[model samples]
Target: MKKIILLCLTIVLYNCNGNAQKTAQKTEQKAYKVSKTDSEWKAQLSKMEYYVLRKAGTERPFSSPLNKNYKAGTYVCAACNTPLFKSEHKFDSGTGWPSFDREIKGHVAFGSDNKLGYSRDEEHCATCGGHLGHVFNDGPINTTGKRHCINGVALKFIPKE
Candidate 1:
């Protein structure tokens, strides 16, 4: 009976090891790709935009001119000018930064952020490997606990007439 129990334990260990190996392989496959060269992106973006998006610098919270903007329009990528968020999706998170409940579908990508040891959602530009900001779960309950903590430098607002 001891030998049978030992065999069962070995089987479970082997299965767990295989699962770990597969997870590692999958992670390697999904590695973030730096699609644009640093110089290329710099040439396309302004100094402030290049710093915030490429260098992962944060803008002053609650200081963005768009934070109080309530007009209907679209916010586009400051670097690539890609449409990212609609004015309709914008909300006051009172967190000092312009917060959005949702993004323009397929414009941003989500990744696991473990920088500070705590796990949080990270947002990145789908076209460029630019760091937009982090997303939090403490947003309005009506819309999913999704807060896109975006940098003011990373976006340019186009007011709708």
Candidate 2:
């Protein structure tokens, strides 16, 4: 009975490890519309941008100038220049990041992220699959009530001409 229980525990542990590895591999294997080699991405983006966009890393809060920007412009994907959020949709969430009440239609993609030990709706640039940030439900009630808390490094602001 002891041997049988040990074998069962070992099998469960192995399966769990395999699943974790598969998840990592799947992330690596997934391709986006604007695929680039690691070298290409590194060459095209700054070190901070590369970390946020390619490695799915988050930037320090209050570190982005766009957080306080209130200009009339469009926020676009830093990687592919895809328009994401318009100036009108931006709001002062006070989260120290650029928060948007909404995204441009068809410009962003959603996925489940469990990195924080809870389910979070992660947003990414649809064109380049760069990690933008996460969305939350606690937003202005007058609007969509969705806060797209994005990494400023993942976007480029194009002021209206």
Winning model by lDDT? 2
Query: Per-prediction RMSD in angstroms?
Result: 5.7, 2.5
TM-score (all chains, Cα) for each model: 0.74, 0.88
Alpha-carbon lDDT of model 2: 0.95
Q: Give the alpha carbon lDDT tens digit for every residue of 1-161 in model 1.
A: 99999999999999999999989967863334446777888788888788889887788888788788778999887776778899988998887778898899998888887768998788878876577888887777887778888987788898898
What lDDT does the true structure give each of the candidates? Answer: 0.82, 0.95
Stretches of candidate 1 off by over 4 Å are 1-35
Clashes of each: 1, 0
